[model samples]
Target: MGSTYRLQLRNQAKPTDPKHQPYRFESVLKVLNNGDEKLKSWKVFVGFRNDEYLVSASNAVLADGTSLPANVGNGTVFAGYPMTDLKTAIETAGDLNQIQVQVKLLGTQFGVKPPNVPLPETIQLANDVHLS
Candidate 1:
């Protein structure tokens, strides 16, 4: 199935001395399928260019499905947890509810300050022809 990837980063809290410590930020990774068929065991690769640490995440697991904490700075692949398949927007009777995977992530990034956005280097569906 054809799909598009979106990454949104936001730092709403104002903390003191962020440069000295990890700057807290929120990130959402979304993949919207616009193809005719649903993708089973889909995987999305998130690339990071900075030293970022992921504190927590939801509705996602490491591509290998083992690591307790998903790392960002080092770059990692995220796979849907439990809900392994990404159904088409129309497959769910146009509800569009299942389309949302709720890939909200909380993390701390070091070495980035004001005027700079903590965005991933690249976001894409890394799964090719192979299902594994």
Candidate 2:
């Protein structure tokens, strides 16, 4: 069976509270299965980047038969970056709008063993929001 999968970013937003510490932001990672094959497990590398440097990075995983829906799963809010670093990068680039989020599927399992499914390349998440 021909099966395909893709990663997307959702619920991207910046912190509105002034009391919030050091330029914090939040977003969700969405794993989508478009094909008919039932996935048993999968892993992906996710990160945020600007024109100059990577702001943050993390890994996500899904297991069991919980991979059937179009919205297969959701990843936790990746608070892996320091606000100072992100601010520095933004200042260096001189454009907050240049930052982008991306994800890459590392591997997948159809059953108890590895499948012939080809790993998809890294893709940029659409509708990325800029932090003020």
Candidate 3:
């Protein structure tokens, strides 16, 4: 009945539990696109007790808080996709509150022209186009 927007997620490396110190992370959020072309970015209210907030491609926390080495921001902007198998990866890592997140994109960044991205033939299944 409606189109779905996919938000791809990747977890930055971080040390948590001594046993499960390293974790694999990823997420996809399917959002119901309203009539507007832009998706409103907001922190998911998963409810955890940390100063971390999703800024863009990486999650961030205020400077006064403990700085996590692996959780450093990557300066990449992204959007929210519908919660999919990605949620599983998140849950496996730990509590959502403990994870830092960032807003992937903004209004001006949304309508920009596409760069020359190389994709395989199979990858270009349908509406794919050459950027340059």
lDDT of each: 0.69, 0.25, 0.25
Ranking by TM-score: 1, 2, 3
Count of steric clashes across candidates, in order: 0, 0, 17
- Record all residue pairs in model 1 with backbone atoms less than 3 Å apart, i.e. clashing: none
Candidate 1 lDDT (Cα, whole model)?
0.69
Write model 1 residue lDDT over 1-132, tens digit each, in one string: 433333365453445565554577777777666556777777787887677777777888887655655456878888888677778777787455565465777777776765777677777777785434
16: Cα error in model 3, Å: 9.6
- Which candidate has the highest lDDT of all? 1
Query: Candidate 1 clash total?
Result: 0
Candidate 2 lDDT over residue span 50-74, tens digit each: 1111133333322222232222112
lDDT of candidate 3 vs native?
0.25
Per residue, candidate 3 scores C-alpha lDDT tens digits across 54-104 of 332333222223333322222221223322112222344533332222323
Regions more than 4 Å wrong, model 2: 1-22, 50-132
RMSD of each: 3.6, 19.9, 18.3
Report clash pairs, candidate 2.
none
- Residue 21 in model 1: lDDT: 46
